[model samples]
Target: MNQAVPAPTVSPLRPTDTRSTAPTRMPWLSLAILAAMGFILVAAETMPAGLLPVIAADLQTSEGVVGQFISVWALGTVVVTIPALALTRGFRRKPLILTAILGLIVANSVTAMSGDVVTALVSRFFAGAFTGVVWGMLAAYGRRISPPARGGLALSIVSIGAPAGFALGTPLGATLGTAFDWRWAFIGLTLLAIIVFALIAFVVSDAPGQAASARLPLRRVFLLPGVAIVLAVILVWMLAHNTIYTYIAPYLRATGTGIGPDLLLLVYGLASIGGIGITAVLIDRVPRGLLHGSVALFVIAGTVLLLAHSSAPAVIAAAAVWGLTFGGASAQLQSALTLAGREHSDVANSFLPVAFNLAIFAAGILGAVLLQSADGLVLPIVMIALGAVAFTLTIVGRRTAFLPRR
Candidate 1:
């Protein structure tokens, strides 16, 4: 096996840290701040799903039209992430991150103040544009600042925000909107962003950006061994995951189980939290095995759903399995790319969110088409097929992508 490439030397921003490139202890305080940033971004992006009815009514629009806010945000991310990362590659990490958080705050604030759908949708676009910058850099940033030996743990800690946002943040935003007003959710997100900005400015350690001479071109980064394969898995896996997720309500309604989409998502989200926890503990020990097991279990879960859609207990059980499989995916994929991209990890990581949002965009269209043309039960069948393909890619990528850590 080829040896892992060494990370590029990062110039420490502080005077006392010049003696060693790596920190002696895990940077919990710094990791937590980054996690907070992730939480805010994910929460801000998905909050609209939970408040769609109210937002639609307030804007005098249909729920379908209001739903486009999420899609537009994703489109903005998909369109901007690669170019934004390339353009800002030379900027210092701390300031760049702070700027992204500030953009989110402003965007969310504007969204909250907007009385018209056009204005709200425009704000969502900017929110997603800024989010592209954030997610593109965040995992790499987490890795850059942590103890060298515990990189996986740092990633897991930072990544908790995503699942937590999906599980806790979105639901809480819904509750707040239901109890008060939909605008309040955006207002609340703005407040949280403010606090995160302050924390990141004060608490997080700064890492220097890639030197111009050391930076890899975007094309080179994409072609790097394992980078493309990892991204392929992400695209396929997430496309399957999001298709069912986006249309989960209609899918559940078709199962004849009388389960509410809200309850099902709650079940999935809580289970996702557990999955990430397990990934953190086992990632370093069995990275390849963990990835294989997660995807394999996902296929099994899909099979159960396909066969037993009418059984409420079986449906809920499968959802939990699905969540568990998906929860650790971000960390696993990012870690693989970090390894694959090596010195060019940050540039490579930029593609991560692009692949994700593309899947999201495609899922929206695909789910709609499927619902129009076929039965909702076909959704699980798609999941099974895609899950199998994702697993196959992982196996085929063993040499390049999921190589055993040195």
Candidate 2:
């Protein structure tokens, strides 16, 4: 496939030397904090999902209208990701990262205080832009923060933020909203941002490419064969999944009810955590396998949700399937982008978040339309169609993927 070679176990930078003064375990600690940053940034973005209904009532808007928070945030990300990554090139890593984290604090605070639809849209739009850039930063950061050999593993760890953020954000927002108000959820996110900011200030170290010597054209970034394929799969995956996921609360409210909404999200988040853990371990060992299972899981989850409208157990089961698949899939796909883009990993990394959020933006629009038009049946139909494309891509991608020869 003529892509970047698969990552080795040791770093690609300096060859592993045991006599160095830096603690061997130090990178792990730094990467973990980076993972936490990934967690909170994502949490801030998806927090709107858990509190969707509450925000609607408080603003006197329909749930679909309130759902624009997710849509606009993603759109903002799509708009700013490339430009932000391009502009930030050649800047030092820690300060740029700290700035991105600081932006989150401000964005979450903006969303927290918004009471009108217009205000919410503007606030969420900026918040989403911050998320997109951070995600781009996170991709390149993951590879350089640790040894190059463990780059895939490093990215796997970074990917933990997606599902973990959802696992924590959805339930945390729901619980906070249930106890205090939806505003409290964003307030809590702001507080976490402060903590993460401190952690980044102290823990994360400088890396290579934090201040790159040169820049590449954006079009030349994803010129590789598998790069576009990975982007397509990510777009299809998120579009299919979020089509239903963004509406989980309302879907439950409409069809049947036995479990509390917060509790339901908690269960789903836990499953997402489980999925993240599994994928992290497998990403290095069996990445394509993990990707295939993840896309397939989406199809299964959508089907389950469609048929299980009457059963609480059925819905819970669907949530579990959805979470586990999404968690693993998100990380594995990021790894795929890194591998496929090869020498252009940084460019690939920057663009990956853009693709994800762009897909989210697309899905947000698709979901709102489906919710209004098809009453949310768009999930199953979209899943099957997207899954087929993803699965087909998986097959073609395997033949041309960045894997070493068998």
Candidate 3:
């Protein structure tokens, strides 16, 4: 049985009552800030992907070596997420959050100024840890402020930031690097981090709940009847999606698809954000049905890609559908996890980022291996197979302990 954790305790945001401690009754501003933080950090994480050549040139390293350095960011987050959260469990939420944002600022600034690869990798490692801590806390932070009945909606609102960051960040890094230098991209991250910091300082609640106080034992947390199944659903779904997504560019290039891959990516990103919009409207009203409908999009998209991978328009349409489903599905799963964990939502929430990042890493490696061994045709089939299986599991398990107790 899950033990209940108290909803967030409201604390004074400021030492003095000079300004509003939060966004005040509306909380929309605060929500936007959280969303922007998501966007900024995703962008920061992806900057290397966009500006690799420029970074390699300035640092006098091979592009291949620079590409390999992505491990510094990935590995850093993977290692630090749990430990950082565990160590900082007792701090005030708002300031710790800002400090996390500050950590990003320092990371990016150090990266921008690094004269050698060692300095840059160290900076990125710090950035990853900072971003990981924030991500670990993000869902709790979002849910804590939400009116219980509208928790899903609030989560969806904040969740929109990831796709938005990808949609904007991929291009922003290239634009800044091409116009000035790669360092400008890091500078951009720093600037955005500062702005997000200001928003957190001014708008987010001075909530007093330290993270670890309510966290349940990880093993026991998953031992709740439906939690593991739902996590399986999430893992397969994420792995399936990332498998195709990580390799879309190469697939398009090889196939000579009539559409521009970059354009399709932007569309995919926008559609993902659109999916979040769909969730915002429907999650609280018909939560289970909404999840079923969203998962079905994956099945449909996978089938389309399987049958018509060569049709540029079909591929494009499939990508949009993919984004829509993925964008919405993430928040929906978070909702489901919250319910599945019963009163121990904090423990459940912490599992999300860890699962998501692992899926990305594992699936990307697996997908790349497949691409090298087989062909583009095989990737979507794997996606379809995984998606179909996940759909079946979710549908069959809908009425199980996975859902919210009404």
Error of 3 at 125 (Å): 3.9
Best by lDDT: 1
Candidates in order have lDDT scores of 0.82, 0.75, 0.72
lDDT of 3 at 130: 86
Clash totals, every prediction: 0, 4, 0
* Tens-digit lDDT string for candidate 2 (1-406): 6888886685333233322232234277777888888888777777777777788989999878777788889898899888887776655566677777777678778778887888889988988887776877786676676666666667666777776887888788889987899988888888988987898788787654433434667688788768888888788777777766677676776556566668778888888889888976776687777777777787787777778767888888888887788767766777777777777777887777787788777776777778777654455667667777777777777865535321
1 or 2, which is superior by lDDT? 1
Rank the candidate models, highest lDDT first: 1, 2, 3
- Residue 175, candidate 2: Cα error in Å is 2.0
TM-score leader: 2
Reference-based lDDT, residue 397, model 2: 77
Listed in order, each prediction's TM-score against the native is 0.86, 0.88, 0.80
Model 1, range 1-406, lDDT digits (tens) per residue?
8999997675342222323377778889899888888888777877776665677788998655666677778888998888878777666678888888888888889999998999988998998999998887888788778887777678778877876776667767777886799989889989988988988888888775656677777998899999999999999998878777766656776899998665777788888888888888878788999999999999999999889999999999999999888888887887788789887776787798899888877776677677777777988988999999999999999999997662
**Regions of model 3 farther than 4 Å from truth:** 1-26, 46-72, 110-123, 143-156, 166-168, 171-186, 211-215, 374-377, 401-406
* Model 3 Cα lDDT, one tens digit per residue, 1-406: 9999987655443222222233224467788889899888777776565555567788898544554345466556767777766665555578778878888799889988899999888888888888888987776677666665666557667877776776667556756775798888788778888988987888787655543445566778878877877788888887787666656545565555766545666677778778878877887788777777777888898888878877888888998898788777777787788778888767676777666666665665675577666766777888888888888878767776445333
